[model samples]
Target: MEVAEQRSKVVEAYIQAFEDRNAEAVMALYADEATVEDPYGTEPIKGRDAIYAFYQKAMDLNARLSLDGPVRVAGDIAAFPFTVRVTVDGKRQQLEVIDTFRFDRQGKIIEMRAFWGPLNSQEI
Candidate 1:
């Protein structure tokens, strides 16, 4: 597949998998040695297994995530802006985040980095 097509597919997979809370589906889009640095963390999560564990924990926490629009891809990389809703301590909140994904030659995502914005900021 062309790099652009691959990028779109991978980005879609991520959005769909997370919205469905299906960790396995998300992992399928990753390379064997993929790494993820999601928000709320300093160290990156390595490998599909680790990513699966991370998603599982998020699913268990009842996270509700949604994308704002189509992901923008450049070369083998893409950036997806998203809004995630979660309930914590009996309060509902929304988190604004931007996720950047880098794909390997095989079109499998090799690295994903996520940045989060301030909580309940008027800008959001």
Candidate 2:
């Protein structure tokens, strides 16, 4: 299979893993040295261990993700828009987000960045 096809498939698997609320499955899609920067800027979580912890918390939030649009693949990166339904502080909130995943040669995600902020969120 073409590398681009493999990369695109990885993106689909990522969405499925999150929908399953299976952190381990999600981690499988990442490289050991992966880094994640949720919401573009803050502090990036570096390495697999840290990345795992970050995702675990997100999983614990009982977050449900729905694709808002198609996944766009360019080179080794995949970007897509999605909506997240999660409960925080006893309130249900929805976030409209776009995330980009940069994959390694083997198609494992080596970097991930999520984009969203107050303007993209709403109390549901």
lDDT of each: 0.82, 0.90
User: Among these predicted structures, which one has the highest TM-score?
Assistant: 2
Q: For each of the candidates, give the backbone clash count.
A: 0, 0
RMSD to true structure for each model, in Å? 2.6, 1.1
Global Cα lDDT for candidate 2: 0.90
TM-scores, all candidates, are 0.87, 0.94
Candidate 1 wrongly placed segments (more than 4 Å): 119-124
What 10-residue stretch in candidate 1 is worst by lDDT?
115-124
Q: Which residue pairs in candidate 1 collide? A: none
The model with the greatest lDDT is 2
Clashing pairs in 2: none
Cα lDDT of model 1 by residue, 4-123, tens digit = 777887888777888888888988888999889876377999877788899899888888778888788997789888887888777777778888899898788898898884653222
Which runs of model 2 end up more than 4 angstroms from their true locations? none
